[model samples]
Target: MAEQIIAALEKIVGANQVLRGDRAKPYLTEWRRAFQPVALAVVRPGNTGEVAALVQSCADFDCAVVAQSGNTGLVGGSAASDARRHVIVNLERMDRVREIDADNATMTVEAGCTLADAQQAAADAGLYFPLTLASRDRCRIGGNLATNAGGLNVVRYGNTRDLVLGLEVVLADGRVWHNLSGLRKDNSGFDLNDLFVGSEGALGVVTAAVFKLYDPVVQQVTALFALDAPEQAVALQRRLIAASGHNLTGCELMSRQAVSLACTHIEGCHEPFEVDHDWYLLVDLASSAQGHWLHEVMAQVVEHARRDGLLSDVVIAHDDERAAALWHLRESLPPAQVAEGASIKHDISLPISKLPMFLARALPAVREALPGVRPCPFGHVGDGNLHFNLSKPAGADDETFLAQSETAHTVVHDIVAEMGGSIAAEHGIGRLKVEALSRYKQPVERDMMRAIKAALDPDNRLNPGVIVD
Candidate 1:
């Protein structure tokens, strides 16, 4: 049966493009090593037509199809986890920048193009693509759109979903929906592009997209402030946003433990302050309007924060190089955690005003539940999303520490639910968080999602057991 499936895939997209067994191992595994998938074969499609054909062929054989691009997703969304017959449809081969309309401020590119490459392409055209991730070099625009990824710039530019103007998708039935018009406003029928964004490939495969761009930033300022608590960061952020006239592009919060981990594990990442503090806030402000005015705006905010006793010490970056250095400390937190040891991570979001209270409650609860567990909470607090990760107890076994994941999740997520926060923030409800989604989501909302899934792929052939199940 597997042999027949492989032969059919080869017929659609050349024999060399079809990989099986050991050759397909790379596509079958996701990042972070959380979920190891088993697929009958991995097919590489070079164009939209080939992707459509592959999907149609998989439906004909009753084999589930998983749409993958870049495979840089943190959750188990891009890979198959069950033992069912599955064919991995990887889009890495369909990388091309179809067009870049400078006047329209939109760029159309294949889903397989890396985020870094796309950003560079926009930069070459003297424009800016605001959506960025630390994994930009490895993550593809398709996966970014599929997951509706949010990163540092979300506070200013919003998520991948917001930056997109149109999408070219292949539905579960192998039919193509082409609407890459780069239209800013159109109220024709339902907003179909939205259904696929952040759907985690359960609805369809994003073949290509038209992304919105912005004017190139002419002046930018970066600053780091040492604070005593998350509340201080929040308070200072409000002052800066109001004073800067909303030019605050990004604001990130890091716990002392998180900062220490990054300084210890990552090379060239040094502490910004002379003395230690309990928390740190990284600030970014950009303006296309030319002037040294942004620097003055940052300095004034710093002075006000100090007067209000909101911060202890602050460091401001005046040049592009220093700005990059300051930003490095913020971006290095993730890789630093990987080096620290085994940790259970949660990507969650709450009301901007409720972050302080949520932290006040969740911190002690998780610690009391698991004694000596190191909490390294940090993330894009400007947009109210925190990467609330917990490092295992000192000298604890990895397996033993991981065993408490369910307990820790319950402790942390229960508080989140009470606070009206989402368990899955930027990351989608992939296979890893499917059960939690089922438990936390409202029944009405869940039923609507399931109805859409059933209507699109009744057999569950497109990414079966993902998001819906």
Candidate 2:
């Protein structure tokens, strides 16, 4: 059966494009090396039609089909976590900027195009695609749509789902569904594009997408400030929004531990303040207005926040080079944590109002459970998401600390539940969080999601065991 399926895919994408054995090694490993993939074959489709045919072939063979994009997902969704010998269909060959309608402020791009490529394409046409992630240079647009990724700019431009106007998807049964409309106001029956945006390739394969664009920011200001606590960060956001309005494009917070680790482990990282503080916020404001008004407004907002006790100290950038340097502290955190040692990571979200309390309690509880455990809790505080990660104690056994991963997860998740937060935030529920989703989601909500899955992919051929029972 696997041979017949391979033959059918090879006929569609040529034998050279159908990879197995040594050639399949690259597609089998997750970005974080969390698991090993046991895929039957890695099929590289060049276009939407090829992807459609691959899906149909897998369905006919009664085999599972997993559609992968850049394979940069933190969760096990983008890679085959299970030992299932399913066929892996990756869109690396389908990369292309089909069209960029500058007049309509939209760009049509294939899923294989990297996020950075999409941003550059828009810039060439004097427009801007505002989906900015740390992995933008490597992460593809299709994968961004698949997980609805949120980045530093999400506080203003929103998630990948919000930037998309339409999608060109290949459904479970190999039928191509083309709804690549660029209209901003469509009173259609249902917003079908959204159904697949955050579906994580369970319902279908996102071959291409139509993304909304924005006017490029000509004036900007960035600063790094110290805050006493998470609650103060929230207070600062409120004050800045009131003063700057939509021009405030980015706001990121880092714990003192996260800052210390990043600065020490990652080179070229320097503290922006004269004295160390418990927390730090990286604030940025962008505008299309002319002159130096953007910087002036941001400086004024900082004074207001300080007056309200939301801000303790600040260092505003005087030039573009200085602004980029400030952003380096926030972007280099994840790699620094990895450099420290083996760690348990969580992509979770909570109400901004409860940010301070959740951190205040959860940090102490985890430290108590595993003495000397280093917790680096930081992320998009304005958007209510935190990358709550824990490093093993000094000179501890790696295998033993990882062995208690479940216990640590439970402790953190319990705190999240008490604060009415979600265990999975920007990251979707791939195989990694399927069990957690079942435990946290309401019974009715779970049933409804499963029903939709059953209706769309009746035979469960498309990325099975993800987001459903």
Per-residue error (Å), model 1, residue 134 = 0.7
RMSD in Å for candidate 1, one decimal?
1.0
**Which predicted model would earn the best TM-score?**
1
- Alpha-carbon runs more than 4 Å astray in model 1: 82-84
- Kindly report the root-mean-square deviation of model 2 from the true structure over all alpha carbons: 1.3
lDDT of 2 by residue, 338-385 (tens): 888889999999888888889999999999988889999989987899
Over the stretch 116-139, how does candidate 1's per-residue lDDT look in tens digits? Answer: 999999999999999989899999
Report the alpha-carbon TM-score of model 1 versus the true structure.
Answer: 0.98
Question: Largest lDDT belongs to which candidate?
Answer: 1
List RMSD in Å for every model shown. Answer: 1.0, 1.3
lDDT of 1 at 293: 92
What is the Cα-based TM-score of model 2? 0.98
Worst 10 residues of 1 by lDDT: 78-87
